[model samples]
Target: MSTIENLLPEELLETLRDRAPGYDEENSFFHRDLADLKKLGYLQMLVPTEFGGRGFTLAQASQAQRRLAQAAPATALGINMHHVILGMAYTLWLRGDQRLNWVFEEAMAGEIFAFGISEAGNDAVLFDSVSTARRVTEGYRISGTKIFTSLSPVWTRLMVHAQVEGEDTLVFGFLEREAEGITIKDDWDTLGMRASQSCTTILDEVPLNTERVATHTPLGPNPDPVVWGIFGTFELLLASVYTGIGERAVSLACEIVAKRRSHVKQAPYAHDPDIRWQIASAGILMDGVILQLEKLTADVDALGTDRDPNYGAQWFLHFSGVKGRATEAAKEAVELAVRTTGGAQYFRSSELQRLYRDVLAGLYHPSDNESLHAAYAKALLGPAS
Candidate 1:
């Protein structure tokens, strides 16, 4: 079990932390950070060991992501998009589905994959898409705009999907960054997680050859292994990042309480029972998030190649719960930290203030509270009559 402590040394994390604020303040991409990560072979963490990579499991990768988020939330969140793609491919490979083995091969060859699945108004998730893929001589011509294309600055490949013309299926494929009619719009200005550079990507007749297409699946839910792999990996990794944020918030709160002095008592705020209680509460909330993350990751690894036929629905139920809980826990922990640390934390320069804004982005991700609850209801009580 190669932990993040061994894979990503403390010195690298410290450097990432030092660079994080500057990137956030400038609303720039973490270019240097990405280069360093590549140098350290962090991008190949999910590639199989036989393919000249470390071949880490989901449990190990989740742990690594949690630690990365503690140093730089935006960086971790942005890179997580790439990791999710690889994680899904690796998961399917581990389950005896070698359809996506090329993804691992590409990773070993030093190609970076970015996610391009999000659209402006369509929220049907993996079940539907607004983009259209017109049949072409070689493969398909993808024409649509994708939002929140993380790793926009440096991704060599993009994993995208679109509805096939005159068919009831959607085409999932990878497109080269330099493909014709591809435009990356620099419109990612937001409240927090600014360094992620998750800009809008436009595709106008972007051509993908036959080899680049990964799969063609029917619209809506089905028993597709790829779909389940993606949903599971994405939700779990996203949850892990926010869990890291919560843990960092709790740590910061403890440090503040230990160092700050009470004017009335002329003693450290740590001595104040009320402040101690707040810190303890934050710790407890973060503990729940971390435990859920750990358990879910372990379950994912344990599934191996023997997953049950109905495991997809069960996985969805569990993933939705963990994602929602982790995000909420992170937000609550940051709020408690802000309260315990005083008004200074309200300033723009305060790390807690940045964390406060960053944690809010968690709410916008897929499997949001309403959708998560809906899935849970469907799984628990069965669909409406």
Candidate 2:
């Protein structure tokens, strides 16, 4: 209750089992029950101590995400966007963006923050977004349209990206949501993760003062420290969300098979060895995902607060590929649940449909599959691969 720790990771698994009643017809992003998150301060788990909020560890945050995913897929998504913003923005404000102290201070007081990185031109991290921020008399005039601005509808401060070409200089700066001339466009109707309210952000000649911009990427230490943590958080959350959906599908499978009457063998469908095998296969994949996450978490923790690495992008590459694998595994788990449950579970009331769509959304992260694998392999056996 005092926000000493993440509070829910250990408790949420139980609450999800007891409290989640599948999908309620009236439940959605604007639902009432989600207020439990804010009331309980789960929304500010990663806010820094100096900023007046408790900041949990990477593993704790990851575990909480898994637990939330089990409760309600939509609520989990909405909560995820909030938590990710707090974690990333909190870290940046606390460790890197010293000049932007007021933004950090406001977040500590429970102000919500969101990331607005995806733009109309640059959907992926590797792309050069066309958003331009030219120098004006007062500060800077930013003109751009960013799509998929998650958590913006409800969040207070949004961290945005724009470029500035100085005298022989090109720099990236992080701007605030309240900056003059910035507007949030609520047009997000994605096939999945809809509860996140991922809308478009319009920055039409926004004026940013000296306090709004964070320094170049990797505000902490290395050549690209900022991106490293963001990438890592993205990868871990991918695994956690998928793991949640996988657990849900498996649970539904167990329920249906238990009720099934084994007309062929004169026993319940629960006794069917084939169905059992399918469940076992799904379990195997889930197990694989957990193992990979364990390894990834440990590897990241080992990196510590260190500065630079020659193979700086190694972790980023690993995250992209592993995320793809875990996402596929989660999809398999959901499919197995639907397949083994038969046609009856396909009803409109079934939660499996929503979970199915959520897992599918995990597939499109705009990454390089071959490049990821090749990088990992090259790291192991020289760059020949």
> Candidates' TM-scores?
0.97, 0.81
lDDT per prediction? Answer: 0.89, 0.64
Q: When superposed on Cα atoms, how far off is each prediction in RMSD?
A: 1.6, 4.4
Output the lDDT of residue 227, model 2: 53
In model 2, which runs have C-alpha deviations exceeding 4 angstroms? Answer: 1-6, 9-28, 31-34, 48-51, 89-104, 121-127, 137-139, 165-174, 217-223, 302-311, 368-385
lDDT, candidate 2, at 316: 67
**What count of clashes does model 1 give?**
0
Clashes of each: 0, 2
Candidate number achieving the greatest TM-score relative to the actual structure: 1
Off by over 4 Å in 1: 305-312
Residue 41 C-alpha lDDT in model 1:
84
Clashing pairs in 1: none
lDDT of 2 by residue, 215-299 (tens): 4542122334445555566667767777878877888888888888867788877789899999889888888887877677555
How many backbone clashes can be found in candidate 2? 2
